[model samples]
Target: MTSADARDAGDAEAFPTVQLDLPVPTNVRVRTAEFVKSSVEISQCPKEGPPEFAVIGRSNVGKSSLINMLTGRKALAQVSKEPGKTQCINHFIINDSWYLVDMPGYGYAKRSKDQRREFDAFTKAYFKQRGTLAMVLLLVDGSIPPQPADLDYAAWLASAGVPFSIVFTKADKKKKGGPRALSNVAAFKRALLEARGFPLVPPSVVTSAATGDGKSELLAFVASLRGMWEAAKKRR
Candidate 1:
């Protein structure tokens, strides 16, 4: 296995694997998805242009697959079964109008601990500095209960004034138990509210890359905010 494979980590056994349970819509189809460039710092990012919506998660959260599934571009973002292959801020132009930013997966990466820390340093700067970032898709593994890292990241986003939505990935995988993903999702909400005292439990959707679940809901969310970031430019 590659270093990426070896480094990919996931929390095992949270609840029953969630089923294909979320309602799906058909509108807001992606007309085109094209990878533009990758950047190490916010300075390297594309000029303050189309609104950018980012996707971020733990290394093994099925983030690449979820992005591919969401855009209906089977190969849009590089898919790695291992964790930490993506080490840059990847920009994908969506419909030539907006950008779908695929951030390096957090919590795990193939890089050395110091390198991972360095990665986080720059990305955090990007989040704080990028004026065109419209939203962040906080991809989470739906099969597990609340993870401390996930909760903390969500809290950080809120504290930083970043608009984000939790997009639960892997809704199709199921293990033997009572309620599947729904239990984990609910537990996550409770933990965020109770443990983090996060007052506003942000919008969330259950999704499965395997079954293309929650694709339209996510796309609809993205569509709803495509050009809204233009206001960010004027404030800068």
Candidate 2:
């Protein structure tokens, strides 16, 4: 057993497990709306009734591939061989129950400073201000150790008190029992603990868009939110 395994065993009951009960691809509604590149455009997010769950990450982190895995629909979102393909806040309404928001990735290359700032401005506004937003799934590349930028972003989210979870993508890239891959993920976990302390952050699930790892668990998390949405609607 690894160090993290021991640690997790010690608190197995403490960590919440995402319920994996929802059927895959029962009914998925995927679509792309306007690409909001500026702050003003983000303000026009649909003021609809369904709660929103936004997926975001740094550039080239496989956000689209992961989305496709979640919906059981290949090519549901634009999967690009190139980076920065998604530059807007894309929304997908699922079973008319929830809205899946795909926000523009931060920190992509080949962009001017002004363009990056615009992206950041729009993302910040969306996360901080979107009324129907229920949670943000912050995708992190698990093939490599967590970077300083990832830690910084997580810290920022915690400081802002935004509800978010860490998703380690590309698990299939790592070979089983490979020392290098294990070390990288361990380092990432250490960095996360150092950056934000242990309990403040949500438990992370390792995933691979290629092998469909963690797909059911992720959907179960979304399904568990059904109660929360019902309560919110009652409040309204």
> What does candidate 1's lDDT look like per residue over 1-236, in tens digits?
53322222121132223232222333367788899999987878899878888888888798778778878888888888778878899998877888888888887845789988888787778888887788788988877777899998989988998878889888777622353233576677767777887765777777899998888777876665552444445687
| Candidate 1 global CA lDDT score | 0.76
Candidate 2 has its poorest 10 consecutive residues by lDDT at 30-39
Query: Which digits, one per residue and each the tens of the lDDT, describe model 2 over residues 1-236?
Result: 86655554454444433333333343222333232222247656666567878888988888978877887777767888788888878877666567677777888878888999998888877788887778888999877766777787888887887878788889778534455343445556666666557543465666899999988777766666655566567898
The TM-score measured for candidate 1 stands at: 0.82
Scanning candidate 1 in windows of ten residues, the lowest lDDT window is 3-12
Off by over 4 Å in 2: 1-40, 175-183
Show pairs that collide, candidate 1: 17-174, 17-175, 18-181
Q: Give the Cα error of residue 216 in candidate 2, in Å.
A: 0.5
List candidate 1 stretches off by more than 4 Å. Answer: 1-27, 175-182, 227-236
Model 1, position 55, has a per-residue lDDT of 88
